[model samples]
Target chain A: MPVPAHHPVDILRFNTCGSVDDGKSTLIGRLLYDSKNLMEDQIEALERSADITGGGQINLANLTDGLRAEREQGITIDVAYRYFATPKRKFIVADTPGHVQYTRNMVTGASISNLSVVLVDARQGVIEQSRRHTCIASLLRIPHLAIAVNKMDLVDWSEERFIEIRDQFEEFLPRLDMKDVKFIPLSALTGDNVVEPSSKTPWFTGPTLLGHLESVHIGSDWNLNGFRLPVQWVNRPNNPTDPRLHDFRGFSGQIAGGIVKAGQKVMVLPSGLISRVKEIWTYDGPVPEAFCPQSITLLLEDDIDVSRGDMIIGPDNLPGQSTELHAKVCWMHQRPLQRGRKYFLKHTTQTVQAVVTEIEDRINVSTFEPEPDAPELALNDIGEIRLKTAKPLIFDGYAINRLTGSFILIEQGTHATVAAGMLFPPTEAVKPEYTDFSI
Target chain B: MNSYHLDHLQYLETDAIHVMREVAAEFERPAILFSGGKDSICLLRLAEKAFRPSDIPMPLLNIETGHEFPELIGFRDRRAKELGAKLIVRTVEDVLARGLATAAPGEVSRNRLQIPALLGAIEEFRFDCCVGGARRDEEKARAKERFFSFRDSFGQWDPKNQRPEIWNLYNARLNAGENMRVFPLSNWTEVDVWEYVRKEKLEVPGIYFSHERECFRRGGQWLPIPPPHAGAGQPDPYAGARPKPAEKHAKLVVRVRTIADMISTGMIESRADSVDDIIAEIAAARVTERGTRADDKSSEAAMEDRKKAGYF
Candidate 1:
C-alpha cells in the first residue's frame, strides 16, 4: 500500500444533522461517491442489502447504517463514522441521527468537529429539528457552519425558497456565537452543487460543497501563537547497541501549535526549564521543522527532566498555570453533574482527581440564553461550572487551543466520562503580593 | 522554529500516543494484542514509536487459534523477532486441555473459545490494560466504544453505560479486578489503517495480498483446504481421500478475500495480486471488512454481543 505523499495534515471534523427525511445520509453518500472514495466491496454490500429498502435501488442511507437494527429500521441508531479523501484534503464525516432522542449522539459527534453541516429539506425549510441541531452546533462552538439547503431539485431550484431558508437561518445565527457561517442552497440527493457546480443554480455564485471544504482557511484555526505539547511518553531506548540513541532522551508528543524546529529554545510547563529541539522524528523520516497536529517524536537537545503528563511549551509564550478552573461543560452521563462530586479530571495526558466547586449557570437551548444559578447539569445540558483539581494544570482558554484547554469529568465509582468541559480564562489572571503592605 | 497550533490529526495522534504511554505507565504488566492483522501491525508501529530508543516496554500477546493461515503465523513470528519484542503465544488447545473451553463434537472453529483463553491469559499475566487494535468504524458495537473502555471483573463491556471521552482526555482509572481495553486507533477507520500502513511502508502478512490456493465451496464461499476436517464429509477431496458417494465437493481455484482461520475464512475470486490492486479493490468496496468474518455473519449484533462478552 502506497500512502499518499500529500497527507491532509489539517483535518476538518464535521457533523451532519437533520430530520429523518431530510436526506442527510444521501448527502454524505453523494459526497463520498462524488469524491471517488468508495471501494468496490462497499458497493457490493450496498447492493446485497438493497432489499432492506424495498425500493430496489440502493438506499444511500445504508452507506452509514452499520447496525442490523438500523438497516431494518431505516434509521441511524448511533453515530456512524465515514471517511473520504481528495487530493487536497481528507474528511472524517460523523453521520449522526437527527431525532431529538439522539441529541447526545449529535453532541458526541459535534464535540470534536470544527464544522457542522445542518441539512434542511427545502420543502420543510427550517423545522424544529433544524433549530435543535443549529442550537447544538452553536452550544458546541463549532467555528464553521454550512446550512445545506437540500432537496432544491424538488423546489424546482427556486431562488425564493432558498432565500427564505437562508433568511430564516440568518435570524437565528445572530443569537449564536458562530464565527463563520455559510449558506449554500443545493440538493444533496441529485448531486447539485455538492461536489461540482450545478447548472440549475446558475444564480448562486458561491463555491460548491467540495470547493468550500478545500479552500476553507484552516491555517489560522490552530492556536499557534502559543505552544503546548502534552507529553504522552518519555522516550528512552535504553538499548546499548544503539549508541547514538543510548544518550538520546526526548519528551515525545505531537506539536499542538506554533513552529517547532530543531535548535529552538523550549521550556517544560510548571518547571520552566529551557531546552532545545535535538531532532524531530516522524514516520516518514527526520524533518527540519514541524507544526501543529503532525505526530512526531521530538528529541530534546538537553536532558532536562520530563515525563508523560508534563507539558512542553515555548519559553516565551506560556499558558496560564492554575489549580482552579472555570469552564462550560456539557454533561453526558445520566447522572447529573453537581457540586462537591469527586471525579477524575482528564486534561491532555494527565488524569487527576477533581471536584466540582459550583454550577454557575445553564443555557436554555431554545432561547440561547443562560439561566443563572442553575443547581445541577443533567444529561445533555450545557452549563458554566467551576472545578478544583488535585494538581495545577498548564492550559490556555478553550477558545485559544482546544487541545490544551479541554477536560473531561469521570464518575468516581463507574469511571464513566460524565461531562465534557471547555475551560474559560483562569480567575487568578492578576495577582500581587507584598510583605510590607500592612505597614 | 516555526510554531504551529495543533490540528485535528496531530491531536488524534498525540492522543493515541498518550493512551499508549498511559497503558505502559499504569499497568504493572501490559501487553499489546497482536493478531498479525493490519490494525494490530499499525499498533505495533505505534508501540515502537511510543517507547522507542527503548525497546517496546511490553510483550506482544497472540492467542493462536491453531487454525490461522500459515503465512499469518509465519509473519507474526518474523515481525516479533524483527522488532526485538517478547512474544507470548497462548493457544485454545491448552485451554481445552485445562477444561476452560469445550468444543462441539463436529465443530471446527474455535473463535468463541478465544474469550476464555484471553481472559485466562489476562489473569495469568495480571495485565491491567490490554491494548488492542480495534477501530470504532469496524462494527456498530465498536462505534460506541470509548478510548478507555472499561471491563468489569468478569471482563464485560457495557455499551449503554460507556465512559464519555471529551477532547483528548481519557480516563484510565481502574479498580481491583477491573481492566481497561485501550484502542489507540479508536477514531481511525479501516481505510485510514491501510493508508497509514502504505504510507509508513509497514510490513504485514503475505496472505493480505491475493494468492492462488486449493479451496472447497461451502455456503456460497470458498473455504481453504489445509484443515482436513473442513472437507470431512465432502465427496471430492482435493488432496486427501474422496468422500462417500452421496456427499458432494468440488476442487476449485480461488483466492482469499480476507484472511482468517483455514476452516472458516472465505475467499473472493480476484486477480488483484499487488498492494495497489488491493487498495483499488478496497476503495471500490461497499461491503465492510468484517463481512468476510464468518463469526459476524451469525447476526447483526454478533460482533457487539461477542465484544460485550470480552471478545477482541
Candidate 2:
C-alpha cells in the first residue's frame, strides 16, 4: 500500500490508564504496532533484547517502559508521550502508569487530554483501580471516555461476558458527568479488535477501536464563547530607523477563549478601561480576525496602562474576579498540604502569593466518596481547598474553560511545584451591580 | 463545521511560538542553541515569527565540536547574518585547551566533550534559559521529559524527581546557579518537521539531500570516507584518519537522516532530493532518524545517560 499523502488534519490528544495487570502498556504497544507507527529499527531493538523477552515471544510492554528502573521492575514509572498518525487524524497518546501511588502522574496526563481510555481486564471486571481511573477522568471533565474490555480471548470471547462487564460500568457511570463513553472487547496480546475487526465477536457490530478513535467528534473541544487574553508580554519595538515601527506597541499573547476581531471593543481587567483593537498582527502580518488558541499581537487605539499579568476580555460574559478562590487541588509534593501554608499561585500569565486558608475535604479515589475536613493532603492526594491571594484572579470555572481555570502552586522556600488546581465558579463577579467599577 | 479551526501544524506552531515568547519574557538572559540542523532551522523561524519586525531578543549559541560539516557551518553563518542576530561560537577545542574538559586518549569523537563547553557557555554568559530543539519523539527518555526541564547548579538531570508539569502553564522559577533547558518542539515528530519545512519554503543544508560521496561500510553502517590529509599544515578536522582493516570502501549515493559529528553520523542510501520526497520517504522508511546516529547506538540508555549529564 502506498503511504498516505500529507494533508491537513486536526489533532487529538488522549491518555490510557488502568490497573497494573490490565495490560495498558500492551494495549498501547498493540495500537502503535498495528498502526504501522513503529519503525523497523525499533522493532529490531525490541526483538533483540533477550533479557526482557522469554520463550521467543517479544514482550510488547517493553516498548513504553522507558526508564531503566521501570524496565528492571517491569512497571511503568511515569507518563510517556507517544505520537502516531492515520489519514484521518494525528494522535498524541499519553501512556500513564497504573500504580495507585502515581495518581498524580495520571492527573498530570489527564489535565491536557481530550479523551481518556480506561482499560479493564475481562477476567476481573470492574475492579477498584478501574473505577478510580474512570472517576478521575470524569472529575477532570474529559469530554470523552473509552472502556476497553481487554483480554476477551481469556474468557473465550463470550458475548455474555462482554455485556456483564459493560453492565458493571453502567451502574456507576451515570453518577459521573461523562457524556460520551465507548466500550470495546479485544485482546491486546492477540491483536483482535484494536485495529481490525475480529471474527470471534460476530455479534459485535460496532466500529473497531481504531475506527472509534479516528471518527470521534472533537470539533467543539475548545471554548469559543467568552474572549479572554492574558497579556504575556508588551511588544514594543522602539525602532528609530524604521518609519513603520517608530512607535509600535502591542499586547502579545495567545487567546484563551472566544474570537477577537479588529475594531472590536475590549475591556482591560483591574482598570475598567475599554478600547478598540486597531490591528491584529500575526506571523503572516495583520489579520482581520482570530479565534481561540491563536497567538497574536493586538494594537489598541488608546495608550492604556496595560502590562504583563493583566487580562483583556470582550464586552460580554465578564469573568469573575475575586481574591478568595475555591479550587480542587491534586497535591504532588512530599510535604503534606495544610492550612496556613503559603505558596506562590501561578495562574494564566501571573504568579501571586497565596495561602491555604481552609481544607474542605478529600475525595477517596477507591470508593469515590468525600471525606470531610481532612487534616492534611499527602502526596498524590486530591482534595478541595480555599485560598486567599494577594491580588484578585480573573477566572471562570474549569468546566467552562480549562485554560483560564487551572493553576499550579509553588512552595515558598523550596520553590518546588506542589499542587495542580482547578478553580470553582467565583461567588461574585467583582461587584456586578456597578456598570463601570474600577479597583 | 465552523470556520474557526486550526490544523495540526498551525496548532503546533502556535504552541511553539507561545513558548519562545514566554522564554523571552520570563528569563533575565536567554539564548537559542542553534545547530543549523533541520530542527533548529524550524526554531529560528519560530523565533522570527515570535518577535519579528524587530531584532530577536536572544543571541544564537553554537557549541562547535570542530568536526562539523563545512557546509552546515557556512549555512549557519549566512543565516545568522541574514537575520541580523548575534551568533556566539564556542569550540570544544577551546574547552580542551583551557583544561575545562578532558577527552579520552585516542578519542576521535567530541560527542561527550560538548557537555562542558555548553555548561561553560551558560555560566560565562549567565544565561538563565537556553531554548533547544529537542523533541520527545526523538528518544524514550526524552519522551518523559518536560517542556521546561530544570537543571541543577552542576547541570544534572534527575529524571525521577522532575516537577509535575500540568498544562501549558510552565513553572520557570530557579535559584542561583540553576537554569532551564526549554524545548519548544517537545511534541513534534520527524514527519512534522519535514512537512513544515516544505510548507514554509525554508532552505536547509545541502547535506540533507542525496549526493555522491566516497564512503565505506563499518559495523553495518555506511560512513563517509575522510580525505587524505590537511592542506597547508592545518590539523585534520575529521575524526577517522584511516579506514579499519575490515572496512570495505566504496562510492555510494546517500543522504544523512540526522546531522551530528561527521564521524558518528551515518548515511542511508536514498534518491530523495526534495522536501516532499523526504517526507514521503520518512513515512515509508523502516529505520528511525536516531537509528543512524552512532552515539545513541552505544547502549539502550545512551541518550538517557547523556541527557542526565546535561548534554543537549
Candidate 3:
C-alpha cells in the first residue's frame, strides 16, 4: 500500500463552557467564521436565518444551539460538538451548555478534553458562572485552560479592565490548581482577537485565541508515568486457515498510560500474576514498543487468567486496590443521590454494584467551599461522597491518570448514567505482596 | 520515536477501532449497518483494520429502500463477497409485502420505510448492536449523539436521556428487546471521510464520482430522471411522482454529496472524477454535505425527527 500523502496531524480536543450571557456561542461562531471554517452553504443558511434575528446580522448562536427547544428558547440545552481543521492541527470542540442546571453536560464534555476555554463576559468580569466552570475544569484535571475575556468592545478594549478580569480569575485559579492558563481579551460579535489579532488590542501582546489553541503544547497531556492497560477484550483469532494464528490468544486494549515493549515484565491486577510480554501487535503489525493511547494486542509468555475488567500494569508502580472509594461526582439524574443508595459503578472495563456510604459534603460552586453534612447531592450538584463496591476497584487518583482515575454511576433498573466522578487518590497504596511471582 | 504523537487520521482510526472491538467483545450478536455510501465504505475499511488477518467478526447488514442506486447495490454485494463476510439485506419491499408499513401515494422516497426494514432485520437476527457509519458533523441533532447511542425496545432515540460517555469507556448495557446503535465515525467529517478513503484506497460505487446522467431540477437540487419503466414489476412506489413530457429534463454531469434514495438524493454538478479532486471541490464548496439531501430539507429538525423514530 502507498503511504498516505497527507501528513499526520495530532488532534486537540477542548470544550467551551460559561453562562448563557457570556456569548459562548457567538465566540465559537466567530472562531469558525474567522478561521474560514464555515462553508459557503453554511453562510447562506446563516443569512437565511439572519432574517429571524431582526438586526440583519446572522445569529451565530444558531450554529450550535441545534435542538428545537434550544433554538426556540435561544439557549444551548445540551452539549454539541463541532469539528474544524487547520493545516497544523484538527480541533474537536465540545460546545457545552452554560446553564447552572447543566453541570452534568459540562462534566461530560470536560471528561475527555485536553484543554478547556472558560469564557467570561468582559462587562461582568469573573462571575459565579465563571468560577463554577473553572472549578469543574480544575476538578476534572484538564491540562490546559484558556480564559477568553470576551466582549472587549463593551469594555472599551481597556487593558486595565482586562487586567482586572485577569486578576479576578488569578485570585481563585490558584485554589483551583490550574497549571496552564492563558487570558485573552476579545469581542466575538465584532470579530476581534478571535482568529487574527485585533488592532484595538495594541496594548495586549498575546496571540489570538485561535493562535493559542493551535500552538498549545499538548504532547505531555497524557499520564505517561506507569504502564496501565485495562484489558477490554481478549483477542483469539483461532483461525484454521492461517497456521500462525491458530493458537493466537492476546490481551487487547488501548494503553491507558505509560509505555510497554516486547519482553517487558508486567503484572495482572486482582490476580497478582506476573508475565513477560511476548509480542506487541498493532493493526499495522508488531512493534518493539508502544506508548500511551495506542490500541494494541499483546501476547504474553504465560497463559494467565485475565479477562475483561482486569487491569494489567508494570510491576514498578502499583495502583490502589480497595473496596472503598472516595470520589467527587456531578450528579445528573432527577433523583437525588443520598446515603445508602446502591448504584452500578462503572470504572474502566469493570462494572460493580456500589453503595453510597456517605455524602461527605457538597461543594458550593459559587464560593468554592465544601459545605459539610449536605443531606443529598441533587441534580447538577457537585459533592464528595464515599462508596463501597462489591468488588475491589483498581485505580489511580484522578490527578495522576484520568483514564484510571475516573468512573461513572449508572442507576440500577433504569440503567441511566447519573453521575460523572473523579476518584480521590488512594489513602494508602496496596503492598506488593504478589511480587514473589516475578521471580 | 521520542515524541509519541498520532496523526489526526491515525487517532480517529484507533478511536474507531477501539469502539469496534468493544462491540465485538460486548454484544452477543453484532452487525455493521452498511449502506455502500462513502461513509460506510470508510466504515468497512475501519472494520478491516480492526479485525483483519481474521475475517470480520460480524455480518454486514443493509436496509435496501428498493430505490437504491444500482451501482451502490452492486458495490455492496461485491465488497461483502470479497471480505468473506456474510451480507444480510432486508428490503422495504419485504416490509411492504408483510403489510408492516405503507407508502403514501406519489411518494418518491421510501426513506421512512427504511426504519421498519432495519428494525425488522435487527429483530429477525436478534442483533443486540448495529454499528453504523453516521457522523455527527452530518446534521445538527447528530452532533449531540454519544458514541454508543442507546435505543429502547421500539428502536426510538431519546436525545435528552443519553448515557454519559467518559474517556474511551462506553456503557453498552441494554435491557431485553432493546438494542444499541454504535457510531464509530461519530467524530469524522465529510472531508475526513474523503481523506481517509484516499489514504485507505477503499473502493466505492461509481456514482460518487461525476458522471453524465439525465436529470431535472426541483427545490434547487438536481435529481436523476428515472426511466419510465423503472422497477417494472409489482407496484411502483413512486407511481404518481413520475414527471410528464411537459416537464424538462437535461443531461448534466453530477455527483452525489450524500447518498440516499435516488428520488431524494440531490446531485451537485461537478467534474471531480478523483478523490483528490472531490476533496478540493469540497474545500471550495459553499453548502453543508446534507444541504443536497432532500430528506433533511423537509424541516429544520427533519433528521432529528427521523432519528428519534429509529431512522439510522
Q: Residue A121's C-alpha lDDT in candidate 1? A: 95
Question: lDDT per residue, candidate 1, B1-312, as tens digits?
Answer: 124444344555566776787788667788899988888898998887677667889999999877777788899899999999999999988998899879775556778888999999999999888999988767656776777788999999876455555555667778888998989998787666776676668887777766766665555566666645565575322232223344345564445555557655777766666566666666666667777667767755788788889987
- Output DockQ, candidate 1: 0.39
Q: How big is the positional error of residue A310 in model 2, measured in Å on the Cα after superposition?
A: 0.7
In angstroms, the error of model 3 at A231 is: 0.9
- lDDT of candidate 1 at residue A317, scale 0 to 100: 53
* Model 1 lDDT, residue A196, Cα: 86
What's the alpha carbon RMSD for model 1?
4.9
> Deviation in angstroms for B204 in model 2?
0.8
DockQ of each: 0.39, 0.66, 0.52
What's the true lDDT of residue A82 in model 3?
A: 94
TM-score-best of 2 and 3: 2
Cα misplacement distance, residue A290 of candidate 1 (Å):
2.9
**lDDT (tens digit, per residue) of candidate 1 on A355-405:** 899999998876668899998999878889999999888887887778888
Arranged by TM-score with the best first, the candidates are 2, 3, 1
Tens-place lDDT per residue, model 3, A301-365, is 99899998899888656789999999999898889998999999889878999999999999998
Of the candidates shown, which would achieve the greatest lDDT relative to the real structure? 2
Which of 2 and 3 is ahead in DockQ?
Answer: 2
- As for candidate 3, its clashing pairs are A40-B286, A41-B286, A41-B287
Candidate 3 residue runs with Cα over 4 Å from true position: A1-5, A53-55, A433-439, B227-234, B238-248
